[model samples]
Target: MALNIKQTAVAGTMESSDVMVTVKPAEGQGLVIHLQSNVLTTFGDQIRATVQEVFSDFGIRDAEVFLVDKGAIDCVIRARVQAAICRASGEGFNWKGEDK
Candidate 1:
């Protein structure tokens, strides 16, 4: 069920308690994740794991994912990832902001 990314797309904002997620088409490479966050020392592993799980759930095996975290929680990470994927794939999706 892996879907190819059509183009670069971004979701969310670099605001407090939120995350900005970007997805782009990658050739040959599969799911490269780059994450930056203030809480990386304490939460890096968890955040990375969560993002990877979200990608797996959406069947996204080939893409370059870049995310900037501003103290976002797991659910926010999931929502932003989903929204970015939808936008990159040209699917209609609206992220209702924080509460996701």
Candidate 2:
């Protein structure tokens, strides 16, 4: 089932090796992402693809995502996105399902 976002939520930090992500409900926006990263010239597409993959995993189709990157790796980015999504949707992540 798709996650139904109920409110805006944020995760992560602006630390040198971290990334901050904000998630908000957008009924018809269809996964809008606003990203700010100093490394955009080189890693923009990869970063966006990582975020998109997380959204797809959670079955999210509509939402507004604001991300501020600080040279974080793909795993960190995925974790932050998932955390924000879970908080916004007021749901706990299904850890068991992911192990399969």
Candidate 3:
């Protein structure tokens, strides 16, 4: 199925070990990300890249991503993004799995 985000959705928390990802629908355009973080000067590019990669992996071409980070690592970033996408798109994370 061509999974797609239907409306605005949010995932993750604003705690120390998490991040908040807000995704909203967009037209025929690419992903536009607005990142807010304490380490923007240090890890900004990496964070944006990771988010973009995850979105690409899920075949997401159009959306607006607003990420409020709280010192989350790459893995956490991936998880949060995936969760937000699933919540927004209403698709589960069993697309590329072997078993439950």
TM-score leaderboard ranking: 2, 3, 1
CA lDDT, candidate 1, residue 91: 72
Worst lDDT run of 10 residues, candidate 1, spans 91-100
Can you write out model 1's per-residue Cα lDDT over 2-91, one digit (the tens) per residue? 566899999999999999999999978988999999999999999999989987877778899999999999989988998899889887
Model 3 residue runs over 4 Å out of place are 95-100
Top TM-score hit: 2
The residue-level lDDT of candidate 2 at 19 comes to 95
* Residues 81-100 of candidate 2: C-alpha lDDT, one tens digit per residue: 99999999999988897779
Best by lDDT: 2
Please identify which of the two predictions, 1 or 2, would achieve the higher lDDT against the true structure: 2
> In candidate 2, residue 94 scores what lDDT?
89
Off by over 4 Å in 1: 93-100
CA lDDT of every candidate: 0.88, 0.94, 0.89
Candidate 2 residue pairs in clash (backbone atoms < 3 Å)? none
Q: Give the runs in model 2 whose Cα sits over 4 Å from its true position.
A: none
Order the numbered candidates by lDDT, best leading: 2, 3, 1
lDDT winner between candidates 2 and 3: 2
Question: Native-vs-model 3 lDDT?
Answer: 0.89
lDDT of 3 at 24: 89
